[model samples]
Target: MTRPAHIAHLADPDDDPFGPEASDRYFNRELSWLAFNRRVLEEACNPAHPLLERLRFLSISGSNLDEFFMVRVAGLKGQQLKEVDRRSADGLTAGQQLGAITEEADALMASQQAVWGDLRNALDEARLHVLRRDEVDAEATEWLETHFREQIFPILTPQALDPAHPFPFIPNKGLSVIFDLVRRSDKEPVRELVMLPVSAARFVRIPGEPARYVTIESILKRFAPLLFPGYEIGGAAAFRVLRDSDMEIDEEAEDLVRYFANAIKRRRRGRVIRLELETGMPEALAAVLKSELGKTDAIITESGNLLGIGDLDTIVDENRPDLKFPPYVPRFPERIREFGGDCFAAIRAKDIIVHHPYESFDVVLEYLKQAAIDPDVIAIKQTLYRAGKQPAVINALIAAAEAGKSVTAVVELRARFDEEQNIYWASALERAGVQVVYGFLEWKTHAKVSMVVRREGGKFRTYCHFGTGNYHPVTARIYTDLSFFTADARIGRDAAQLFNYVTGYVEPVDIAKVSLSPRDLRSDLLALIDTEIANVRAGLPGGVWAKMNSLVDPAIIDKLYEASGAGVEVELIIRGICCLRPGVPGMSENIRVKSVIGRFLEHSRIFAFGNGAALPNDGARVFISSADWMPRNFDRRVEYMLPIENPTVHDQVLDQVMVANLIDTEQSWELEPDGRYVRDEPGDKPFNLHRYFMINPSLSGRGAAIGASDAVPTLSLRRRR
Candidate 1:
């Protein structure tokens, strides 16, 4: 790929705050995240996608924004309240960034509403009607009335607005109803707020053909007289509040667990960051809400359609397989089956690399199951970060522990939004006799590594499983992550050191292959880059290829810019929140950046660099890590970056995954120095990388012993070498 003249424009200081003339060109972290959300929203508008899937995407986008507001926007608001006007690297003050964010978010909300409108119509044509109050039939209305009185009415507590009643406490992210209350005898009106019952369904499906849906707000409107029988009906609108839900802990406190408990309580009562009101609300009522909530003008928003459309997740349960993509059940690799489901045998036969969803996560599950039943297995060591509903991984650990095997599981209780799930798993593991250890009080242990110590042939051998993703099997269908299984003693020993570092705080000084973070991963990466830079200066062929979820650490970007200036080729596949400004002349002329968005989320952090040779051995380093190239990953969390050494695993990652992503034109978006992402124009020969993976088997699979058939020549002779 050749550099374009637009690179000069990108490098101009005026184009960005950190242009060539200025100090640095840094993109706002919050803005880059918003752009990622926008890309997610774009999926809803993609007509080429399935209608229900598009709706699901919209709901997911909405939920994502809700969290972003609760965390990111709320944090910014806190900074502003503290009179902290620290300017971001993008040269915008906290208040200025907040103002810009409000404008951008408002526009995004409007776009969401517009897209929802189109999706609703499309869904209606497919025989699904999200009905208004007036659209419900008389028979369904009677059924709903009975259902409301029996189910909803008993649980609802409606407080009359008077001297006796005070404003009800609104929980964070709680949806409610606000109205103008007027007396029956006298037509004088006063403000009233009726919090919509949280326990009730957001969408009530009307009993009829094609399943008509009515929102809870609409139902409340239809039954307004029931709540206020004597008072004259007044204007009512639905609203929702998003409060600061991010937990804060007292690091200086004596007990970390107690402090977290206190933090959780405080999080529930966090200050309101956003107020979303129904469309056509009485202006006076809206103003009163803003004043009561202590919100400024910017916090108030008029939601023209549904206030909390994330409830559409209920609609997505419609069992309409025809309207959705064909559900794909993961296939257990033939390599494992050929070994009669012996995970150890399959892994030992040849280095096996399995792609998730396309290739079964069963291999991971089977690894645990095999260990659980194996009489020779002595101990199992694992890390639990975010285990989904019914985590088979946890069950396997429990089984192993119950079977009188030494099982140690490091469970992170501080996984945000997953604290409850983690807590549940921790308790379950404890009950099952598993030695569950909550990580260090200060740092989160985010590394994903599992080990099994087994006695074979009168000797103990450690089987290590290192993955770039979580142990959540549910997410494996969507998130693209990498997993490596090996019996290498050196790698297993390094993993043991990592486990001890978290559970026992014994940091290893020298690691044979693996590089650990919050300690050595950064220096190791920098050293690698330095080696590449030297090669470039030496007039040797050198290049860098890295794939990550996000990149925001300025120091790393600066290092990359220096490497770019050294004539080293740098290609980045950053899925979200990239602060680096690529293709800037004089700054990053040799750098190119692209992101892949497709049916599956583009995850899996892979880092590779050319060894100034055809194959990278000790000279060329390739790593798969669980950490994103961010400040938190480097300084705040415990992480690991393990090198891919085995020949088959190396070739699969380098020649297959890395090469395929670099050449993909479809589903790719290029980020400009101006912080705007431009989708790659379709090539003359359109190539869908995701489709290719779905249809074709990976190189690792084809190269496997079982996949080798009579039609193809055997590679046994080559392997003998």
Candidate 2:
């Protein structure tokens, strides 16, 4: 192949496929992400949602903001400190972006606090009040006092900030309370700090009929004077700090695992990125905190109530199902049920595409388990990006390896936030004799693939499983993803080739059925966009439909804008941040953008191009990918986008997943050029895509397969007016 076209910056004038007008309407990527998070925080106040679910949304917002601070904010801070003046695609300098981000973050935090207040009141109405230490009844207080002395006081370490005693280390994201203390004999005031134990619960549920509660911090604050007996009681204010948690590893180091362990330890003491203080905190106390933490006034924020609301997740107990969404158990595909749950037999019968959450992940577990025990199976190769505490997938891989099967497991060591767990799995896999390769040092291997090389009848054959999500079963239960199981020779060969490239760096010359990143994924996509533009200019029935977690690559967005301007209808189903502004008068008149937010997370990446023809195979191009349209995926990661050539699978992805997301109004938000996400209100005939998916079986369902035939449903194509 001609050394593929050089990758150009998204904002370069030469790459502006969509004329000048389209560029003007595009929103800044960073700002659009902040807007997406605002929507998440907004969900906490949504009256239509259940109270517990709303609380869960609040926790998600907090966790999301923490990640945003650690990565995005820290990255900007680094760039600014290095005096790098490179502007973002939207033309904003690092300092400018930081200023805008701080303003937006403040507003988001304000909204979060407001929603928390609303949720607290709503929880109170439900007879579950989170009481303060002073508000606790006399009996509850006495019990708590005894409980604290037994459970907490032993772990407490209070340090005074004085010449004699140095200020202790304040860990990242750790909560502490600053107070004024006066000695009995000297009659002089002193400042002190108290660190909250990480392992302890943030809220202590009072023993009562109605279930009142008190914060652990509040209890600690009330009992601080007791810990220091000769000191007079003084005013105290609680605060928390966010730090740069992103890890930096040296590839040249001899011991990768030990280096990471040390890095993890250092992460706890990372430079503070943000400092949150309790509302109405005295200026003196706030100033003391700033000086000690070495943070500027710009980094300080004040909020009402709980500083770390993610702790609310503990309160959303499984015991309270009545206060949450009705628990819906996933159903096994009737085809599997028809075969007495023989995964191998079912998958071998025909290529199948399974939609998760609606369908049970038990089937995936079954596949691996069967392969682990099957005498016919000779070897297995798998790529693991993220897995929960106890992954059945990992167990299956270990079992297969121990059972004398040749298993090669490529586990990415740099899965951000899950690095520690990956390290643990690496050790376990290594112990089991599984060839565990921690991918390339420079790139993160993110493609989700599993291959089982088996002997069938007379010859060795490859059975491949390509997915748009991680192997983590817990996330599979909530994140919307697609899984493709196939016996196609070309696809199997392609998958095997990819494993080779990642493990041994021998890029296959004939990779027709898929596009792998860090090699060809970006250029492949750009060429596809260019082809779509060609068909549009040729006056063919051209259109583009894509769904991903985010869209920040400026070049791709510009191309899509050009396609739209050239009379190609563009429809997008972005679940999170989207920088490309749609529906502007002259810029994106032909483009329409909608975001889907509901009970489950929309995570599958689907791209479709109408190649001047009809439906399935009628010049229609479809692909399922493990990458979002982000710059990192394009440049710094090993990702893949596999074409869905099998007509049945293509129809299921396009006709079902793509179309449903496009029309979903209840959970959909429309994006404006001005970085505003306006929720599509309840109209006369409000259609909720999530509710529909819950009740309506997908096109690949057993019933649909038995009834519907070779004719695949083509989604109604809408075009620019």
Strongest candidate by TM-score? 2
**Model 1, global lDDT:** 0.79
Residues 139-250, candidate 1: write the lDDT tens digits: 8899889877887778767665656877777898788877677877887776667777777888988775887888887787788788777676678888889889887655
In the range 1-721, model 2's lDDT, one tens digit per residue, is 1110111123445444444344364566676788788888877777778888999999888888888988888888878878996777656567767887887888888888888888888888887788854577778878888878888899888887888987777777788888888889898998888898888888888775687778888888777766778988677899998888888768687776788778888888778888889998888888888787755323778866689877778777725666798888887776666677777677777788888878877778888999999999999999999977776998999999989999999988788888899999989999999999877777899999999988999998888889999999999999999888887888889999999998998877799697998888888988888887898788777778999999988778888878878887888989898878777666577888888888899999999988787543465899999999988899889899998877777877888778778777678888765556789875765666666666766544645422222222348665412
Error of 2 at 624 (Å): 0.4
TM-score between candidate 1 and the true structure: 0.92
Off by over 4 Å in 1: 1-24, 188-190, 295-298, 614-620, 698-700, 703-721
Q: Model 2: what TM-score?
A: 0.94
The C-alpha lDDT values of all candidates are 0.79, 0.80
